[model samples]
Target: MSDPHATSPEDVDLSRFDAIVDVRPQAQTRPHLPESTFTPLERLLEDPAASLPSTSARVLVVCDIGMRSAIAARELAELGYQSVTSLDGGIDAWRRHGLPLAGTDSLTPNELERFDRQIKIPDIGSTGQSKLRSASVTVIGAGGLGSPVISYLAGAGIGTLRIVDPDVVELSNLQRQPIYALSDLGRPKVAAAADSVAATTTQTATEIVQGSFDSSSAADLIEGSTVVVDATDSFQARYDLSDATRKAEVPLVTGAVYRWEGQITTLVPNGACYRCIFPSPPESAARLDCALVGAVGPVVGTIGTLQATEVIRISAGLAPAYAGRLLMYDGAVGTFSSVSVQARPDCVCQRP
Candidate 1:
């Protein structure tokens, strides 16, 4: 018969324990069993009664492997505790049994393996990964800038990606928009972008809107989005997105590329919005189009990658890096620079 004071991880009825305590070091106690209280093995060894609940309580002790918890359980038993048990193989064995962990229960085994590298990061732990899986980001274009943004965000495991674009792919787009191919020519940009994202990862759901993003449709397009990305090539669309995001109180990652230069910035609600940098759209006559000035593929890619980074960071519960600042890249010179931005007192963002 098994020792009454020891139980296998697979056989333990967690609900029966009045107190489930983790006896590992504080740092090693992450991803522990649900509802478990932390009491390091060293502390329990120092003062068993002081480190635990009432001796009469039904307690379950756990550690990384079975060693620490077994020792802890023996100490508790020697102290005349009414009932106590140790997890046979500890948390490692429990994990091997495919049991649920406290902060990562929602993530599937595939997701844990897919995002393992990032999850190891102290700041972007399992909690941040969960946030990424719950976030929705709406990208307003699927061309040069939107291609990389959609691709990376999908790879990063964004839960939902809503793509809005009215244009169709063409031969000219292949020069910069790597998300599409010759076979995708004449296909709607949104549809093609969604296919690219689908090929990247199944974790993110894609929402395709085969329509232009204008003032009339901006709000409806961005509704329920955790973040918005402005990747359109027109000043008019930028102005509309700036106004719409500000009004909706959503964060916007806006970027632009012209020739060999590109600039990116993140606009958070109540912060310096796009309009704070450009109070109004420039005159049509003065505006330069990518078709006219010609865009460099890497230039747009650089900005798009940065925009994707901002969205992932924001979705993961981190502060926006470029909020109230403009980050500019000059590919021709291989240089980067930033300038501080402030909201205009009379700007629409500052109004009620």
Candidate 2:
């Protein structure tokens, strides 16, 4: 076995092995092996459970290094396996490298390959990506917050992106709103931002609403949408979005950044809508706008990226990430804080 290629698949250490149970013909990955011990998830993904023995069984995953087996062992536990052990030394280090072992497989459909990168996540897989294609999302505001939100959602292949922004970008907005170049300063942000989304590979379709989200028209804007992002910069609009999204029964990803500080929260269906968190709108403060306080690029960027992440997660059939929680950041101190939130019992959004 000393030849260059023949010297491969060496022996592995078993000192750190959690437990090694060969299930090729035996049993035990979880504490109570079902009539058959094969993972139900695997059954649903590939072959049927009828292919496995009905007595009991466990599986061993062999990798170049035992490290991956160790990691996969943990993965099985998280998937409801009470007892999953790994080979301390990997396949390369195994004494009986040729030992019989049952192997698992993957699903690699042609369409799924386009989203190969996304399907790798546990929270989001090919199944989740499919849900995203069937989901609709509405984003309010097309400035700083909407920039990254639209960009990522588009890049993530969200099925539909609906943007409603009645404002135009001003010359002064180039500081943080990079979606609009200096060349299009006076153009409506909705059009410019919509164009940005239209260029992404994952973006399938987009709709731009050139109007503010008011009481009368909010219903149409919220119709059939899975979620809404409140990236607007006005207190009235934020509150309006909060109220409207609540009635629409869609999760709301709200973002706010001032100077070097930023905060994000999932509202409406996730928790008490924003009104519960901010009981009464802080007395109107005309002087505290991002324009007045001066927001840094990264601050708004941070908030916007999180807003998009929340939107995609919810659309993709994952639980609302920020449900009952708020994430606040202080750039100066680099401190982050999260607090719990509850829905107001008597809020007017009892129906959506």
Best by TM-score: 1
Q: Quote each prediction's TM-score.
A: 0.78, 0.69
* Model 2 stretches astray by more than 4 angstroms: 1-51, 54-111, 346-352
lDDT of 2 by residue, 1-352 (tens): 1211111233323333333433221122211111223333333223323432221234444334455545555655555544344545543355245432222112224434566577556456555777777778898888888888888888777878899999888987777787788767778888888777776554358889988888778888989888888887877777778878876777888989888888899985646877787766776444237766678888899899989888888887877778889999888889989988887677654444
Cα lDDT of model 1 by residue, 1-352, tens digit: 5666789988989999989988876523146799888878888778877756788999999987888888888887887887889999887799889887896747887998898777667567677888999999999999899999999999989999999999999999999999999999999999889888888799999999999999999999999999999998988888899889988999999999888989999988878887788887666413337877789998999999999999989999998999989999999999999999989999877877
TM match of model 2 to true structure: 0.69
Query: RMSD, each candidate, Å?
Result: 4.9, 9.6
Residue runs of model 1 more than 4 Å from their true location after superposition: 1-30, 37-93, 282-288
